[model samples]
Target: MRDDMDKVIVERPRRGGSWQGDGRAWRNSKEAGSHLGMKRGYHRTKWLNENLAPLKRWLHKQVHRPWDKVYAELCSGIDRRSTVQAHIFEHIDDFVERGAVMRDGQVWVSASWWGRGGRAPLEEASHVELFVHPLTGILLPNRRLREARAAQRTRHGTWAERRGDKPCAVYHVIDENTQWHRVDGCWFEVTLAKFPERVDAAKREEKRYDVLRRCMVTHGGAGRRPAPDMPTHASLYGRNDVYAANKRQLGRREVRARLGDDA
Candidate 1:
């Protein structure tokens, strides 16, 4: 790369001088501009264009090969955060569009119908082919699958309201085998299930003061002065540092006792 730097033509000197015909002499001249300023900028841009750009272009070409071949030859051996891996994931759609990625020939079905093998086998049933991101192995859904998911949301919301439950928010719980959806305080596995008895038991055990505090904070409590150590709703929901500290204080006596024993 440094050897290529000599090839860049610097801004010509205003004062005429005989050609030294040497890279170092040209670089050292005042008209090449100060090393700290335009000279450094010129060298950096030239080196990048001459060396880095071509290398990146070559890497992209390598990525355009069939995913399995590319993975076996390149991605599998590299760290997930490596530039090559990042490039593959960032341009995943490009690979799919170009037919460089493999298609499993599987259609994406609604999560509600996923555990049932698939939705109804009718000829007009809504199902769309699923595409896989070769490098990250993430499934990308097609238009019909996306529409099905939207329709499912509408159905769930209507059902919850009809059952007299306040539709607060949607939450997802993903595990190795399944993804559970929770809406309006009801948990559904695969499809809508009865609100679990275990959740009711847990809710019954919640402290009255804690429940009251949450209610106040969530419902226009911002105008009032907050408790000295109260965590904001954003922190609580985000499970950030403030939430971690609040959690530590939840069973402070137990924690202190454990720490004393360790000491």
Candidate 2:
């Protein structure tokens, strides 16, 4: 690999009109021997190789590697900058010519660099092969894996999931006393065991509800109830609840009255 990379540097066009159009232009220009030129080339090579070199090696074989394997290799030390990402986009065609295509996952390669307006090809011929993703700079086979990964991250962060017919908040229980909760779009660690008072209060509140139900049952569904009185009706009516007052309850007398003949 080192020999191959060294050969590439040695074979780079030293001086020509062609160099003017490529990244080596400033490095090989008349001012190239000066301190400023050397500094310019040094920074460019450093930043460029920081991401591009491994990618070249990864594709040089044209053998299919897993998306994560490639991702881990290319992105290892990358602090991904817009400039570097753009540089990768510019060189993507060179790799495509080397017969590289994503073995798995989608690549969202676009003519537009970094999703900013730019000159796209007159036709989509060049993209029939491989393309680099603008945002992640990682080559994907399609958009499905990228979008799915994003959605998974969102669900994990928000503690939300689709259950039955509705979206519901999810609590990931780590243990009897510990769980994760999403609050205000951030995840928080909650330790139920640490709050003995809250645990006691919850138990007492549950007992109160049980006692209140028994009281309602014994007092023929009417009573001067417990200290914290239950609301007679919901304080606010939702669209679905406006007709709730007439709904039949098995515990109520109306069902028995209607069933007198059958009884």
Candidate 3:
């Protein structure tokens, strides 16, 4: 409903292909395939094995079905230049063109698993909750969704936007699972997993920052006791962007040590 969000794209521009795929029209859309008694591939196995699966299992346990499977499948349909380009972050032009990906106040916002219906937020996560930028939530505004749908409509012209569309955003929750959620407002995508080698890894730095932010008291001192559960900094993620953002303030080794001297 609201627009006017971040233009804070990765400073480097995307030198990739157009986001032309929209699974809805593909002869093999998972949803379409379901009708014909088939299943569609969602995301790359690496993304699944490394990032989404564990969270999916937990969320499904709560909601009785994994919603990400649907969203992932939809994302899978978005056409790109190469396998690497299948990533969600690569298609900012579409976001910019349609405006689905907009800054919420100052935070970026986009639809998460909104239309898929939530399976559940992960449990037993290291961090129970996350926070938005207060003024910088990220968003996938109307145009972004429209462009995505237009991409989908290339094949799924039979369906309508108001029918399948939803408003969603990703979450940065840590604990039992780490996947997207279709919630109002902006939710940070937090994790404490191993560093991502997938993309340029601009976000790992951020994860390390989360680690330091979690470990230190307001005055920048370490906690006397580790969290009762999980390894040191077990909940912090080490993506590249987050890392680069805070590099001058901290170093990789120092941040990793917050997880532990061994990490």
Q: Number of the top candidate by lDDT?
A: 2
The 0-to-1 C-alpha lDDT of every candidate, in the order given, reads: 0.35, 0.36, 0.30
Ranked by TM-score, the better of candidates 2 and 3 is: 2
Backbone clash count for every predicted candidate, in the order shown: 0, 8, 55
Which TM-score value belongs to model 3? 0.17
Q: Residues 102-185, candidate 1: write the lDDT tens digits.
A: 235433232322324433311112333333444555433343443454454555556647788544433333332222333233
Give the alpha carbon lDDT tens digit for every residue of 1-263 in model 2.
Answer: 33243334223433322222343777668966655643454432322333356556556453344444554444443333644343444564555422223323532233432334533331222332344444344443431333343444555543334333333243344455444433333434444321112345334322122221122211122233322323221221111111111111132243236333221
What order do you get sorting by TM-score, best first?
2, 1, 3
Q: Candidate 1, which segments miss by more than 4 Å at Cα? A: 1-66, 69-75, 78-116, 119-141, 158-163, 167-263
lDDT of 3 by residue, 21-53 (tens): 434466454445445423233222222111323
Candidate numbers sorted by lDDT from highest down: 2, 1, 3
**Leading candidate by TM-score:** 2
In model 1, where is the ten-residue run with the lowest total lDDT?
A: 240-249
In candidate 3, how many Å is residue 260 off? 20
Using all chains and alpha carbons, the TM-scores for the candidates as numbered come to 0.20, 0.21, 0.17
Report how far residue 160 has shifted in candidate 3, in Å.
Answer: 45
User: Where in model 2 is the C-alpha error above 4 Å?
Assistant: 1-3, 9-13, 17-60, 71-108, 112-125, 131-263
